[model samples]
Target: MTSSLMRKGSRPLRLPLLIAALAFSGAAAHAEDEPGSLPRSFPVATPAVAALPAAPTLGADIAGLLEQARASNPGFAAQRAETAAARERTDSAGALPDPNFQVELMDFTNQMRGGGTTLVPGRVGETRYRVIQALPGWGKRDLQTRSAAAKAEQAAAGLDAAWLDLALTIKQAWLRYYAADREAALARESLALLGGLEEATLARYRQGLVPQQAVLRAQREITTQRIAQVGIGQRRRGAAAALNGILARSPDAPLAAPAEPAALPSALDLPALIARARAANPAITADERGIDAARLERERTFADRYPDYSVGVTNNRARGENQTWDVMFEVMIPLQQSARRAREREATQMLAAADARREATASRLAGELGSAWSTFTSAQETRRLIRGTLLPQAQATRDASRAAFETGRVDFDAVLEAERQLVDTRTSLLQAEIEARTALFEIEKLVGETP
Candidate 1:
């Protein structure tokens, strides 16, 4: 039975091997049929070394950067274009309708049969020409133009909002890059100090004053600091790249550090902040314009239920003959009640939706303002703590630990630990400062500060 089972398994394996052999033979034959053919892979560039010029950094101030971003950002530029188009549409809404021209040449006969005798026709062709134009009903053009103008104003406000958003993003990116630069510097400083400690430990060990273990520990710390410096440098580079990207630079562009801030306001009153935000916030203005647009649209659409009238003159001339003119009036009746009804309903729905959106936007803005205020407050508190208490205490501890270690009072490990603590405290202080600046930026952006 065992021999039979082995034979069955071996038979199946032979069939697979035969199939594999067939596939391999087919592949070999195909390769031989195609002479001097490279295997499929990524295509080589037609021109080697597509050297591109290094992109220039704007190195512009915050205001100038915001302006550049406004021009470069697709969203902001598109909104600006849309606003201009809407303005043109508003003008068109108030313009007169196109005129229509008509001409007709009536019968001109060379001869007329009168009592079986040929007679020339005395009166020739009667030619008529008319210019027809549709004159809008009273206030119709005004209403239509008003509606379009309101929409255009809304678009302008929308552009302002886009600008605000781009400015906020730029500010955040700049602050982050600045923080990365500072952190890199700190890491380098720490590495240098660790190197000095490492050398001192080796010298003491050589003098038979410290153990080999102490020297090895200091060496390890220096190595770790070097590694940290490398990582921090990479982070700084990444941050710089991001800042350049925000300014619409190519990947290879070099961006200068952001300008240092002179100072920040110590405190901002909540009432004043809210009032300024209300005055400058594009979202609120957009909502207001939207309301106006919806109201005008409703009125205009209702007015459409009535008929419009036109008046023009008709003229006729043939072969430089005397011209003839006829004055006439025309009126179109709105007989499609269903279409009118649908338009009114559509306008009503749009108006309601706009109002609802406005309410929602107001609610959302309030929440955002509250959060921003809280964050700014908390960051301020953190900065105060770091400056007045935490950093100074950490610095004192590190100094005392170093002195004690020098006097053979404390171990080298304790001194290293104090140094690490001091570094951590300083790092935290930098972080808090960055957070405070970022929070201020957010609050100002939400409040629509220009710079």
Candidate 2:
């Protein structure tokens, strides 16, 4: 063809090509939506699931499940029960010990030889009845009560820690589900875009405007996207199963995809966060209580090395004389000084161990909080970069490449590459957003609120 003829032929195609490329850009932009909503599937929605009472929203469902677990999860319920029992024991620790009752038959045996009129008696039989009570060494009972109360506090702290951990687990599982669902959707969108490009490329190849290799490349990308879709679907199912396990449901239970997590909390001062964790973190509280309990036990054990006494009032019935009452007292002395020393050493060692554990736990928790804070900040920064800079720039690149390809100034490969880059950036943004929120959940677990 002549030069002018070639230019004229290309001129007619430029408008149509530009229109198609613009449509491609529009589709890429539309592929991603508000993170809060992702389409989820029910592979085989069971009749039981369908028949349940009004289905709760995702957040509501999570909240309700957490509440249910307080009574349903065996581990949590057991810990709660232990806490209650310990609290009950604290009340009994300071109360007076139960009294002992005794009855004695004295001089009641019958004689074999009966020289007198009465054949059965050597003397008039007397019955004695008594009640006895033990008084703990001074300060021992009080120490016991204090120790019990402190241990009760420990149990309560342990339960609180378990509850916080449960919340963290739920948040992580929910985020995974959300991420998987988003990944699957993006894969499908990419597949559709590639399908459209494949059709367009085949048309141009047939017209001898583009080599057949372009058509094959588009087809290859479509197949790759399809494989990714399959993998993402599997991940979604696995994530959903894990979430259902937390909810105490069957493994195959269906769930509505969780909505976007709430935004990350405002940036926090790391030192302030560590201080909050020191004060409010349940594990630390539990350990501190353990130390108090151990110290009280050590003091009580030292007091126990003294002696406890028993006192009683006895009523005696005597046929030969008038009935009489007598008072009795007994004292128990600790003769095993070595054993007492051993007990003291055990309590001392236990107290030392508890102190060490508390320090280690606090230090570890502070370090963990710092790490989570860093990760959260990184994710937040990455998401902001993708949204404010990377995504828009990628769109512009796609648009520019499409303009070049339409005028035969660039290959179709450049436009495809730009589109893929945009999809990838969008995916990364979604993942970073989830990671940031998950880290925020971890901090909340430690600090009693978002740090």
lDDT of model number 2: 0.80
Model 1: per-residue Cα lDDT over 281-356, one tens digit each: 8888899899999999999889987889999898766433677668999999899999899999999999999999
Best by lDDT: 2
- Where is model 2 poorest over a 10-residue stretch in terms of lDDT? 110-119
Candidate 2, residues 355-407, lDDT tens digits: the string is 99999999999889999999988988898889999999998997788678667
Residue 367, candidate 1: alpha-carbon lDDT: 75
lDDT of each: 0.77, 0.80
TM-score (C-alpha, index-matched) for candidate 1: 0.77
